[model samples]
Target: MTRKTVRIAMNGVTGRMGHRQHLVRSILALREQGGLELADGTRLWPEPVLVGRREPALRELAGRYGLERWSTDLDAVLADPATDIYFDAQVTSAREEALRKAVAAGKHVYAEKPSATSFEAALGLARLARDAGVKHGVVQDKLFLPGLRKLSRLIDSGFFGQILSVRGEFGYWVFEGDWQEAQRPSWNYRTADGGGIVVDMFPHWEYVLHELFGRVRSVQALAVTHIPQRWDERGKPYDATADDAAYGIFELDGGAVAQINSSWTVRVHRDELVEFQVDGTHGSAVAGLRTCRLQHRSGTPKPVWNPDLPVTHSFRDQWQEVPDNEEFDNGFKTQWELFLRHVYEDGPYRWDLLAGARGVQLAELGLRSSAEGRRVDVPEIAL
Candidate 1:
């Protein structure tokens, strides 16, 4: 069977995610797969035409990747008949405008998470795409993690019967810009640029929570800005306008509860950088990024709570390495492939703008809860 090559115009090609999705994922990785060839010898390759605001950066990126087609003019790129899709990894502030232009030009759209700073803007973008009759997707890379996949299998198989509750501990101490080189982008600490831990990460948690347990019914959150000011890349001090840490409690259907603690100011002293522990009436499971620990009903044991007592329970020993069955790419790269297949093959792609809007809703609710000192009910998003 003949394969169709989908041409992609990549916006923000000079940015971090743009470089990864365009040069590494779309160009190199997909090319290595013989253009998304199936086991049965079918192929679907995406030809990338890089686009960015800076001509020098775009030219440099194009030369580095040996890409013959590149441009700084978004309008011209959208008007080109050869482009079938508009890919965006632009800053959150620029997404709505860029996607509006792309949909107006009749191109399918795919973009990074937190698709918009506001829920209304995200809804508008989704409606615009739907009205234009174009496929659309938002990156949900955590769903593709191998460890999470194992947990999903366990849940499906009833390993954790009658699940009770879930706890997520995710964080690592990020250096303050004044003391050491800041690890994350400067805009991430500025409210003007839609920077905040809740806005940036809750979307991931929303999808994970919905996928694992159920939809969130309500959220009560407490958010804090630990570092009030930070230095930029140029070593100039600037006020940190976004919260660096957030503690959230989510109530799911069926009386189940989930607690999430996300911070950029805490050090990791655990087996992995991120850990999720789910407790149930039948058994309990603890999952790290690369490992899973299971304690079934039969293996349950009671131990002393004395801090001086020698630890007897083999809690850490129960964890085993998950065998790799298929070659898995990096999280971002994996989502890119799925989005590509979703656009071309009509695959099951549900990470649409509405889902992205839910993320914005959660963030907005969190902020309101913090300010008003009360819990916020998350209203359902109508697609």
Candidate 2:
């Protein structure tokens, strides 16, 4: 049994997504499971160095996870020749420049998505990684979700004979600082701070829709700041310039339409914070974070439309719940394992920076569509 360690420089891990999802849930979890196993019985162990701006946060995270490496000197770590992978979970505005530096340092690159604020910048990062000959990837965690995986299986198994449409409902009411403490960071409401519902959620929607149905050919979006003013973390009043909500219709390659509504101002009434319903000719399914329900055309209840009669049948109860027959790992960890394998073994890792650039392109065009009050065509990005 042969084993080796791959040193990874993790930047901006003090943040929520980085610390919780990437470092703790994914990397540490992998370490706990005795690392990733390869086909030839070669186990790949990850030696991750936690890099951040704050000393206290870095120390706290390392101590909590029982990790050995922690550093505030990003430049020093980047310049080090031993670091194998450079993973960035920094703010969107800072991602492009930091990534360029990482590629220049000759490190395999991976990062959180909406890789950059603009499509050009995102694509440029991909080009840089390509030119540097470094393995690269972006977090596409939704595709690895258990519910979505089951849906993919069903699709492959021909459960849904002819897919027709997809409707996504994603949102939860975020508290303003007036009464309750704001759940999300104050920067999310500020446009200058690289925040908006469109830029944030459209990327997820783009990948999900593309992987499940087909490519998003066009988008007709309407984005708005439902709450114009809100109090910040310090009880200071500020105008929310970025959009808090985005309603969009994505036209897929095969004419299958996907409608998605993303919001931070809406109240949650559904099963989860995010859910997608796919309707097909043979069957239909609704998938959430960890669960999915299905209803075939044969099992669909027939109800007579009568204004005088009260509704008798429970339509919601008709759908059968999809059972989890196999083990389901954390979505972030799943992708992390796959990426590590891709880095070590050249596995088929599809969510590269170019794919991430397409997501940014979709977000940019979505915003454009909303501003111009017209549908925007999504042109394919040349690799």
Candidate 3:
């Protein structure tokens, strides 16, 4: 098979998501597997240059991963004509300006969301990329999840006659870093650094709900900082200005409502860290990160809310497991391969920068709903 190398300038490679997901698991894994196969007996190879602020960190990462290229100066990498793509997994606050610069330099751009701190900034970037005539994309990794894929299949197969509502429970307890070390980074608790549950999880919920049901028409949210203060990575205490938990209700276009509770302070009680239960007229299904269970109308048990008597039937045991028909890859890697195909081949990619802006818009609207204690309407993004 003929092979083509697409040189990628990857920024924020020193960060957790950037280094692990984008660099190692996706791009490098593709290279090790002899590149992505195109339909026309051709392969696309990802050639990435590690770009970051710290040269030492970049050098260490490159050497550890057996990479030949590492650059601290982003401008220099952008100026290089060999760089075909500029990928960013940096913080949401830094993504907009970096994307602008990358687009101006005539490179295809892709990044993690919420793409920017605000909707205006995100839509502007989308518009700018469109004007620059570059292929732009955003990371919507959850859509490719195994469980969600199954759920989508059920939807497509008409397993549910008429979907009614969806309830999503996501999150696990994150240590305050006093006695035990925190799982997430310290910046996630700081609003000044663009960290909050509403901003982080709303984007995921928006896309998930839209993909499963329809576009979100409105959002109502309640946000709270459960732990007002927490210890940082250096063991220093700092005030947590961002919302640690967000309880939101999104109204979809088809009159379906999705209720989601996202928090860093909550304990997991489901099959996975995140789970979604969709109730419909004909049947119901619950999906986690890697597994899905379904309950048909004929198989569903009748339960009576009797406080006087002890429960006899086990509710959890009534549901049947969904069969896995195909092998599943890492969700991040799946999207990366599709993005590469969209960039090089004539692959149909709908999750563009405009789609990303919709995510940002949902987050922004969710915050507004929380602040004003009212439902906020979501407007369509033209870009």
Candidate 4:
């Protein structure tokens, strides 16, 4: 049986995430890794039709990838009978409208995280996709990271017996764009563009926590803008309206707690910028980018409160380095593969719009908590 080739129409193909991460890293790189073979034992390569506002940019991208189909009109691409799926990596502000259009056209949809800025908007998109009977997914890429995979294994193996809490330290110093060029997009600092760390990242935490422990019952958080101004690619300065940092505490089911500190201002002092420390009754584990350290209760040395003594026995000793099992690719690419597999082969892919909405919920609640000076209970998704 010949496998059905999935024709993908990518909206916002020239944007930062669209060009570097989603298009180049995910779609192109995944094909290089090895295209998907369906359940019927037929091979398929994602045939993409690049859609964007700029013709020259689209042409350049298309030519670079040997893509024959490219267009500037999104509606035309959506209306094309050849398009099997619509992939969106557009800005958050543009996502709901584009997704609604695609779903109305009866196309399967795959999109980047924080599907929309607000929870209600995300829920509406989810309902639209469901009503259209289209397969839908949002990127939840962190779960595929090797370090997180190892952490999940530890949790599943009962290494972290009666898990008490989890701590995450995520961020690095981002350039101000005045002296040095900003590492992220300039639009990220603008609220109207759907830019903020809480909205951008909390969904990632939601899935991670849900996967590792359980559902998050509530969240208490504070979101702040550390840098008030930033420069764009062209060196133009703009007011930074989005929060650059977020401190959040998630209350998980079964009484476990997760604390997430996400910022763009902190300096990285370890192997990777992102790290997680898990503490349980039996033992504790600290996982950095490629390495993990384990300290069992039996090995935990008791010491008096001394300010001068070297803290040697506290969680230390590097475990074996975890090598990348999949072909070298960004986290987004790995997630893209999973979504493709889910769509074509019926592989397990639970990271749907509901999951995406949960992230938005966290961000919304976090902002509310910060403004109201109180904790916010996370609301359950309607569907």
How badly does each model clash, as a count of residue pairs?
0, 0, 0, 0
Residue by residue across 1-383, what tens digits does model 1's lDDT show? 76878889988878876686556865578877777864455687778888888999988888997878889889999999889988888888998899999999999988887888888888888888888899998878777777787777779989888988999988898888787998888898999998989888888888898888998888989989999989999999999999999999998877789999999989998877778888998888877776667788887776568988887667666544445556656766777777777776776788887788777778888888888888888877786
How many clashes does the backbone of model 2 have? 0
Cα-based TM-score, every candidate: 0.94, 0.98, 0.98, 0.93
lDDT of 4 at 366: 86
lDDT of 3 by residue, 136-227 (tens): 89999999999999999999999989999999999999999999999999999999999999899898888898888999999999999999
lDDT value, residue 63 of candidate 1: 91
Better by TM-score, candidate 4 or 3: 3
Worst 10 residues of 1 by lDDT: 318-327
lDDT of predicted model 3? 0.92
Instruction: Give candidate 3 regions above 4 Å deviation.
Output: none
Instruction: Give the better candidate number (1 or 4) by TM-score.
Output: 1
lDDT of 4 by residue, 1-383 (tens): 56556799998888887888888887887677567666777767888899888899999999988989999999999998889999888888888889989999999999887898899999888888888888899888777776777777778789878999999999999999999988899878888899988888888888888888898999999999999988999999899999999999999999999999999989888678889988999988877665566777877767588898777663344343444454534678778777888877778888888788888887888888988878888867777
Off by over 4 Å in 1: 38-42, 312-314, 319-326
lDDT of 2: 0.92
Off by over 4 Å in 4: 1-3, 309-315, 318-330
Error of 3 at 257 (Å): 0.8
